[model samples]
Target: MPLSAASRPGGAGLDFARVLMEVPHGRLSGTLLVTGDPGGRFHLENGVILEVTSPGSPGVETLLLRSGRVTETDWASAVRSGAAGWRVGAELVARELVGSAELQLICAMAALDGALAMGMGRIDRVALDPEPPATCFAAPEGIEPEWLSRESERRIRALGGQPVSPFRDRLSRTDAGTRLLDDGIAGERRDILQRANGRRSSRDIAFLLGRGLYAVTVEASRLLHEGLVDVAPPALGAADGPAPAPEYGRNPEPTGQPGRTEEASRLPRRRPGTSGITGVLPLRPVSGPWRPPTALTAEDRRFGSAQ
Candidate 1:
């Protein structure tokens, strides 16, 4: 549906297209609208009204993966084969799976370009205006649940070229916390606390820290408790981002022991059998070679790897 400028508020431009979705029973194509985004959420009133977002540096693009378009297998394959993550988002475009123009749309959506409403389907009998997207879309009348879940996730990925629900929250510091603190937070912990500079979530940090998630959590919590770190609220979309290096030597003091290795005590102590476990201990002690704390202040990092 090509809506005139007058039909929309503030003369916002509108563009509509019909894309065929490859589904099991048969090909399913829905009418998608591309209206100027006042809010940057490349939102489309498609099957169930969806919002698409990206991480890291927000790009300019609109890669719509509708619920009725692809399959679960397609999404997993793209991810497992190292295809659909943010690093690969641009690659997918480069490979021509998505168009340059589409990329612009996706970017606009991510940035919340405008306050607008986009309709889906050949007709506009049912429309949503600035409505919160439906999390789990109901089948079109008679569609099966099995098919619904698969198609829903697929459509979700297709629209955003990303996963439906976020794998983790934005402010979380799972693994990266371990690494950045590995050499033992070189200076006062308070300096390394902001999330605005693009700190990675625990998942992203895990890859960098070369440590398990549990270990990272312990380290992050220790930093938080000792007033060295602060958990930033979740970003609007993806979690990982670069953070500005903090100043050091303002209060250089390694007050904690061996960098406060509290991995064993991070978990909450719970009663046995309460949560279905028969006989579970709250925590198990660890015995290993003690590694000295590694420095991690802005000055330490700038003064070469040796701090």
Candidate 2:
């Protein structure tokens, strides 16, 4: 299917694409508003697909596909019919498209990209109707509504302030550290890293992975040490004050030991020269035998007379 392009009333160029996405929240339901113009592509996971609806915000002249409005097949057919168009690379998974997974994966990627782009101020906030499926709002001073969700707005703010790919060099510089994104690093790493967004502690990462605090501390430290990530200090004067110091390297050992030395100290000690016994029994020396005879003399004489 061809990728669609349009021009919004406000002089901003719009581009739209279709993708299948999988979100942690749920399965694929319908099409979503993808991006303004020249924004990064979004993807959720391998099995998800998403269809981009707006390359250019068409204003009232064109129809914007609202979230949760259509299915993957619906979007696919629309694209083939020229009513809608696919984004670049959307065609790759055309054969394997699974409604929920592919679409949601696409949504996740788009969500991340949208969040990042939103950070750059490419898009503005608009009034969104509050409901189970939240709405988003962003608009320039006097234009028609540009909707963004409260959550989406926050994500954009958090992601937009940082350098893209904080760990790219570290991931590439060494074999031991490089995730290489081999098979791609999109799963847990991406999930945790995105959530980290500078607010989470290394201990949090440790807990999340069920790993030792030291392990998580090292991993996070590696991310920072390699310059692939950074910690986000709390906003100035927020009532929360300073974020409490991270209790790093504090996760207890899996075997219930606080640390190795303490467990080793609890083991029973060996006593010197106690090989035969555990030293629970005392050793005694053997004595040579000696005979006693006075009480038996009378009985011995009688025995000899009878013989």
Candidate 3:
């Protein structure tokens, strides 16, 4: 089937924490597409997350290629070898590029980080696109949504108010720290310094270096705090106040208005005897003799009250 779009919101500032929670609450199985400044897809099976893809998170391919675990030729060849799109992980495992446990772990991390990316940005609308992507290195059993959402929310709160967001702010080396930055910089910090050219963001750097987006953002924040990097203006999907709610139990605000009177609001009560029946239950025609329908007596009322 075609990937049709649905559930587009008509209002602004739509928070999709409710929809994200609904997947687990209803035990939904499909690809939940979140669309906004930096939205992405959450692929779930039987309400557990199989994989997730977001601009703020690096996938298995990026992690494998950019980290020099595999070359482009091998990656492309393996992709061609997958006939049904789900065996790429097995293919890599067979070739000894990555262990099965390592692949599952990477898929789980990608899902968690993707969810964090969704919460970090503004979510305009959420819709279920039943069709998942053709090819993705998904975890075999998948991760539970409750655990995934909570952990992602924890990471987001820890990253609160940082100068550099994964997809929002770009950074550049500070002129004042030019000599200091190049003096003894090495490892991840040095790699980030090389990419922080006032154009690319933490998301870009993560894709380029096969590192996690949140880690790159935190390091960039450290650089900014230490007077080594200067951040550019806020990008399209900068983090805002009122972080998304993590739990699925969150209730939406009530939109119904109350009536002025009890009678006005109440439905017509038409239970058993409200129809003015003149006989007791099993009110049927007599077989042998015609008889008048007996009216309710005081004893019957007393018996009813006793019951």
Candidate 4:
């Protein structure tokens, strides 16, 4: 493992950072459509982050309904009563289902978490959308773009690639993992362990359970380190590569079957004394802000194309 985009000046993370900062510096308003797995969009209002949407993270509706804070019937009713096109938050507040301040906080958290989820994956290309849709919930006094970029990076890099991505890594239970569940664990990790049944990614678990993607991924990483859970390989077509065997979660009972399921752990693991957890590597100290060379070329603008 070497320094990644998070640490490398020329990485896509830095490119996005530049874009985020530059757009806000000019006090621009638009949505940045970032392309990648479970790609996301950042809606900016005069350079302030109004909302962010991503498939890798739970949205406001998931946080409301899936968490049991709001019932399906009530939510549907509110949606029907929504005004200003998509302002469901206002309806919820007016109906006394949720508080105005609380709704605002939830909107802010969802947007920031969505940005975090986007940071955990590759960003291929970013295009600006001038007419971004108004969300059902909007964060009051929206987040500043510079702080958004900095904080998002701080959160993502703090994990240091120890966590598997909800977008890329699908989890399954190991024999040990099954035992952990069978022994009757409790709380969020327990729920996460129960759902790591060889099919759901962390995103799926978050949506199903109304948990934040970051929280679920962190717990999954802990389970992975404990040998209680493992990453299932990608589902490739027949022509993709050498036919990889299908990975399945095992029951607590051990069968006389000769092949062990541990071999099915497809994701890479770190070797001792190496930064092999993922792309995370120690960043060299920076003396100043990074700038393109004076002789900027078309190639200089290419963000992580070689990666």
Q: Which model scores highest in lDDT? A: 4
Best by TM-score: 4
Q: Model 4: runs farther than 4 Å from truth?
A: 1-15, 82-84, 233-307
- In the range 248-277, model 1's lDDT, one tens digit per residue, is 111111225312212211112111222211
Off by over 4 Å in 3: 1-15, 82-86, 131-135, 233-307
- Candidate 2 residue-wise lDDT at 261: 20
lDDT of 1 at 9: 26
Each model's backbone clash number: 42, 58, 0, 0
Quantify all predictions' global Cα lDDT against the true fold: 0.27, 0.28, 0.58, 0.60
Model with the higher TM-score, candidate 1 or 3: 3
lDDT tens per residue, model 2, 37-105? 223232222122222222211111111122223444554454464422333123223433323333333
Per-residue accuracy of model 3 over 35-123 as CA lDDT, tens digit each? 65456788776666777887546776677777787777877788788453666776887787788767776776677678777665555
Worst 10 residues of 4 by lDDT: 238-247
